[model samples]
Target: MATLTILKYPDARLRQKSKPVEVFDETLHTFLDDMYETMMDSNGVGLAAIQVGNPLQVLVINIPREDNEQYKEDMLEIINPVFLKQEGEIEWDEGCLSVPNFYESIKRFDEVTIAYNDRYGNEKVLQAQGFLAVAIQHEIDHLNGILFVDKLPILRRKKFEKELKRIQKEQSQ
Candidate 1:
């Protein structure tokens, strides 16, 4: 599969809420493969369709493992996912594929139980924690037209604003 170009923050498309996948066909599968490839190519642990200029509720995640070779099976593909429940809370340094080279501590659920369809239209539920939980929430936010940077506090937000502006300037040049 070919890697897709990830759209950076402030792109109008990233602000648009993704549409749910209606057809679990080859096209959808192909898109998901490309998304995974793109995520790996960009060295991101997770990605959402909106981050790649597509308005679809699709996300891919592969949390880094302590033993790199053994982690190949960690990748996940979720389509039309819904957060069923969340419990407790944890603050973690979160980053986004859409917003490169930036990270900030954001409060998120320590555990999340979610229901989502697979690439083949089969349903699945996952109880996620730690980095996986954080990644899932971040990607879901993208599907809902939200970015991890939007979760930052006022002071921290201002700090990141300068970097974001610099990235935008570079993109336009």
Candidate 2:
């Protein structure tokens, strides 16, 4: 497995909506493996295929549970995932691998149920809350061409855009 390049915010390609994965074949497995490696290497809990320049509805998440020592075994490889239900609300600071050095407090569902196809083309449903719920919502948004920043208020989003520009300029120099 290889580490894939994660597309940063403001890249037009990141605004593109992803298509669903049709074939559960070897290539799909390889890509998912690479994505998992990339997400781990980047120190992110979740990653969407679109973030890696692949416009497919595939995402991987491994939000380590604090109580679990075998967290690595809990990695989820989701394909064509959709929200089955969402309820309650929680406000939490969220960060994205694609957005880089930015974290914003966003309101998200406190609990969520999602249905998805596994790597082997088996259907599965997952119920998650807390950090896992937040992570799932964030990654699923990428499948629909939505970024966390897009959920920000207008003023806050503008401020973030300015800050992002400054950072980009500084890095270039």
Candidate 3:
């Protein structure tokens, strides 16, 4: 496994929509392993392929449970994920691996049923709730070229504008 370079905010590649994975092969598996390494190294609960400069519909998510008990064993490696059904609504403070050091209250579906191809290229359908659900949706949005910052309210957006610019400038250097 290798750590992939995560594209930070203002990177044009982050705004580019990802392509679907046509064939899940050894290369795809290697990429997924690298993505997992990248996500763990960055301390992010979830990551999308586009975040690492690969514009492909892939994501990994593993949010720890609050109680720190035996969390669900499902460390999802979803390829070409699709939201089959969604229900209810909740507003949660959301953060992104791409947009660092900023959290905002973004409205998201509280529950979701997703259909995706697993790492082994097996079709699977699953339901996610609470934080896991929110994380899933957030990363999926990245595949569609949408950032959490774009979902922010105007006032909030302006509040972070300077910080965003500063980060971008520093990254370039």
- Residue 28, candidate 1: Cα error in Å is 0.9
lDDT by residue (112-136, candidate 3, tens digit) is 9999999888999989988988999
Number of the top candidate by lDDT? 2
Identify the runs in model 1 with alpha carbons over 4 angstroms from their true place. Answer: 68-70, 166-173
- Measured with C-alpha atoms, the lDDT of residue 162 in candidate 2 is 97
**Number of the predicted model whose TM-score against the real structure is largest:** 2
Give per-residue CA lDDT, model 1, range 1-173, as digits (tens).
99888888778889999999989999999998899888888888889998888999999998988765325478899999999999889999987777878889999999999999999999999999988898899999999999888888888999899878887789899
| Per-model C-alpha RMSD | 1.7, 1.4, 2.2
Clashes of 1: 0
Task: Per model, state how many residue pairs clash.
Answer: 0, 0, 0
Model 2 — which ten-residue stretch has the worst lDDT?
63-72
Better of 1 and 3 by TM-score: 1
Among residues 3 or more apart in sequence or in different chains, the pairs in candidate 2 whose N, CA or C atoms overlap within 3 Å are: none
Task: Tell me the deviation in Å of residue 169 in model 3.
Answer: 6.0
User: TM per model?
Assistant: 0.93, 0.96, 0.91
